[model samples]
Target chain A: MTTSDTSVLAPLADVDPADLARLHAGLEAAADRAGQLDIAYTTFDSPVGPLLLAATETGLLRVAYEIEGHDRVLETISARISPRILRAPKRLEGAMRELDEYFAGRRTTFDVPLDLGLSAGFRQLVQRQLAHIAYGHTQSYGQVAAAVGNPKAVRAVGTACARNPLPVVLPCHRVLKADGSLGGYAGGPATKAILLELESAA
Target chain B: MKTGKPPFEGVVAEHSATVLRVCRAVLGVDEADDAWSETFLAAMRAYPDLPADANLQAWLVTIAHRKAIDVTRARQRRALPVENVPEVATTVPAPGDQDDELWHALKALPDKQRHAVAYHHLGGLAYNEVAEILGGTTDAARRAAADGMKALRTSLMGSKGATR
Candidate 1:
């Protein structure tokens, strides 16, 4: 609907931008305090691109690349998890720090707690084994499938790695194709290459 | 569970400015911030149960309306006469201090007119939605907002014209 068409009322029509920002920050904090914030998220500028870090009170939930569409990912999280989400950067501080260290090459393993609610059954089992692949090491889809106790599920393993909700944190980039080619990645192929190079160089 | 609702953060990010302007118009700036925060906090709490197709801006304005009423009631209870009054000074406003004459004029409006203007004009809701919130017919809500704007123009512009 259009606002009232009166120039004398122009000043009343809009809120100061800075004041609106301050109000948003306050509301975010208030929501967090009241334990109503079901999911908290923030964006970080990473070497791969901007990463969307989101979490629930349970643990770190989803980390998305800009290519994945941050808005779409958030909608998915809202649908799959809960719609009570807020952009509160402070809640993701722990995961952010661990990722910061991982990208800096100073840390190999993620110590932050994770919420694997986005995946289930076979996919969850596949992601659980990804962290054991070692930092600079590579594992074939067949190998991961075998390791997860489904030796015949090689293609399934490939699908799991491709659909991994938490990519960098779960080390899906370490899983490669049987032909030694980077099969596919959620963050695109070039990003997978950058992550692989970052690990191998360290 | 529904599988297509957009994140509540999107709701907050998109409509917060409008909500703030609505609150400020209805309750004045000092009370507006608290009303805005309380409204969002309440909205977030009940968000999961909200229908996916719900009008988010109108929904938020509904919540803001309730919150503004609560704030107004609390302010009324806290209203007390001061023992000593400072001398009235006609000091010019400081650099960062907002010019509050317009806000004062808005607060002086009758409650129905103030609410109608805030909900329809600033909150961007249709007259029917404003009527729903204010408990009246759409035409009445429209008339109240129009009347409120007319009064504000007469007072604020008339004062400005007198000075010039």
Candidate 2:
């Protein structure tokens, strides 16, 4: 971005491809060294903006929509998980393929290993319950609360769904309001609508 | 203490290009790639323990300097010329090609001077940092770099005049 850089590098600008290839080779080596890595992640563009996907040794941990600020999410992951994270797309290849299939209406359920590290206890319980809501099916927040053995925790169920770390995988978008209307979504209202329409049409 | 930072991927994305540039400047086009690969691999291995307040670029350049030294020593030990990988062929190794001339001039300097110019001007390290890299006093580093630049300019101008 600086003129100083261009002046200094004037001779080398033409020699790009060879250096880039070497960089990739080195990065591949780094990627292969997974022992020091606590998390590996990548971004996949979806029908609804870019989805920032992160994973741990255990499994896929975080699925953040563009609305959640991908940079901020990565910082949180570094703070909460081990800071030894890298952008290794090979780790997220399966999740991306599955997401592609789901968006194309060729698949309903995600099969990638879920980390569930971000959500736990009652919230995690609610996430698991949400996953059972079946593709193209809708469940009221009250119904989800009752299923999780906290019938009086209608608001809690809504909170759990909104904070669902892995949205598309957990099918949290399938959770509707008690009056059968599309409820709030962490990924934004328009994205929730698009997901609902995608599912219903399938 | 909350020492929050972007993912390691962000770090790589942010600085890999600059590191490559520095490597190429220090090592020249033919051997720069190998030095660059080693430099980044080493950086990534040690990235987790790097202090939050560390100057990431400077740290990377330091690693690059060490890697360059290792690579140069290895090349000297080798008896055979390197097999040229297929490069994007540019016709006419033309004169006034400032880029090519710069590398030629850089490689022509004395070892200490070459390193001084590279670690200071190209790698953007301070005199003290360059001194640390070169294992010399700060004054020595500054003098070597200045002398190196004079030699580089003379060689470059000579090349330009010959072609004209």
Candidate 3:
């Protein structure tokens, strides 16, 4: 299906816990049927908060808020993807290493490969702009738009930042309003502020 | 002609972490980073030809998996096995040590089972979807995930004696 269709099919947030459990169980069963499906999972600290990382045969697959129910996040992801899920700590080594170095102020840029296949144009443009934001600096949405060669697309850029999938990796938190206001983020403005503050401190 | 390039950058932003996870799982961490980049670069090249109905996450994962496997094979052929593949360090949290144990148990499953479990339990994919990306049928995917869960339950129940 189109990426949009898949995005639309992503498990809705309001699914009942009981239903989520059932889905989770079904997933477990599916994994068994497929034989050994290797996955590596780990928990790491980020500027925002504790994060749970899940990796598979591809790359980093799930980065969930630690405070959020892992099952709920799984349900949301599964509703859009597949039934084979595993918890793998070993798989997260690359991300964890990069993240640790980042937090320690030893690394300024991330070399991890990113897959942004699910998003569309405006959002992609906005995320790209966010990436160019210097580690210790911030830019307004208007500036981001201008950077993307669409100075008139400030509102669109804001929407793009709002929908950014990679969040910290793409540095969407660096996008602010022309008035120097912190723009909205899917991860919350508070988290964005903390990220900005953390980068600034570094 | 393709009217416009698909919003690949947007897709990367949304799904990069997920794709990275898949690469790591398949190729381990050292090779995963490279494989992950290759997957995206390939995706960019193929974007114009991709079907609209394809699930972007699954599609990317599939590509990443292939890329990881390719890298591993190439490395093996070159006799350049990466030494000292990093292990996931266990940092005990003040609370919730049990969950950590459970996570460790989940990690012990074989690769295919792990992928199935991660996709279903963590990535939250349906059996059919998992099968599609993993190159198997729904039934096969279900069976792999079930086997993995069975192993996990057994390991967790016997944690007292199981190797940590």
Candidate 4:
């Protein structure tokens, strides 16, 4: 019950919060507002097509192929992860730059941190193993399955590759059919062929 | 009462306007974004530590008050290219003349009173909380805010008539 030092203050004038909201949205969309939105995403155009990169505070979340559709991809991830999503390009700068280098044939492996919350269980296990398949390298789906301690789960490995949340970043394109033929790819076989050719040419 | 922790985005949605009003009052509209950004950045970094029952608005405004001081100090050390900057380079639209007059008046008040008024009225903190931020007994903060209000009433009217 001590005496306080301030005088009675007048009510401040009403300000339009809409301006602040819009400003927040604008910042969250671009350079200023970083690490605030729960899920921040950006789109990058590569030789394959428009690639959608989404991230969480943990790290890079998803790298969606064009065939999956960026809007649909983002909507699905936002629902699964957190709904407070925004197009924060600043947060995706590292991924974009790395993708650029990869596409330019100057880089062999991805070095950015990844948020692998999209996949789990045996699929997650397979994805981690897939990441180690270096540039210009291809392993048969059965080979990848054996690497994950389930040599008989050849079809499971194929399923995992098809459902990869991060295709290009995790290098899931390196997995193919047992007969050395191009298997199914989430980004379409044509895109897979492009990636395989790029790696081989590199 | 739900004991669940609402997301940090919810905090931003709930309190951004109050924080903006506090910053605009203390730093004026031109530099308010600087304070706003710094405040939220700091808050987000420390959000995990915030108590579930904490007064979210007051906590944010306190961070904002500290950030405003930092901006002022940084501005002091930097060279003043402010006056010579071209209009086209500025992104934020200037406030309308009427709003501009109020800003001019608020900026004219003494720093402590302006801060006191902002923290108490705009930021919606109690006098005791304002005192903690302003570094005084609650009574002193009350006096400063009252004095600031008296000055604003005089200037808001005087400046309005004179600007015509």
Best candidate, TM-score: 1
Model 2 segments beyond 4 Å from truth? A1-9, A13-18, B80-101, B159-164
How many clashing pairs per prediction, in order?
Answer: 0, 1, 86, 17
Candidate 3 C-alpha lDDT tens digits along B62-128:
6766776689788767755655544454333234454444445555677678777666654557788
Error of 4 at A50 (Å): 18
TM-score of each: 0.91, 0.85, 0.44, 0.54
Error of 3 at A171 (Å): 0.3
TM-score of chain B of 2: 0.80
What does each candidate score in C-alpha RMSD? 3.1, 4.7, 17.1, 9.3
| Model 1: CA > 4 A from native | A1-5, B80-98, B160-164
Error of 1 at A129 (Å): 0.7
DockQ of each: 0.68, 0.46, 0.02, 0.14
Q: What is the lDDT of candidate 3?
A: 0.62
Name the 10 consecutive residues with the lowest summed lDDT in model 4 chain A: A1-10
lDDT of 1 by residue, B1-164 (tens): 46678888878889888888888888877788889999988898998888778899999999999999999888656654543433123333344433476676676789999899888877888999999999989999999999998887777777557331
Candidate 2 local lDDT, B1-164, one digit each (tens): 34675567777767777777777778776777788777777777787678888988889889988888899899766724655633324323466676676776676678888888777776778888889888879999989988887676666665456321
Best by lDDT: 1
- Considering the true interface contacts (CA pairs under 8 Å between chains A and B), give the fraction that model 1 also has: 0.86
True contacts kept of 3: 0.00
TM-score of chain A of each: 0.95, 0.88, 0.70, 0.85
lDDT of each: 0.86, 0.80, 0.62, 0.80
The best-first sequence of candidates by lDDT reads 1, 2, 4, 3
Superpose all Cα atoms of candidate 2 onto the true structure and report the RMSD in Å to 1 decimal.
4.7
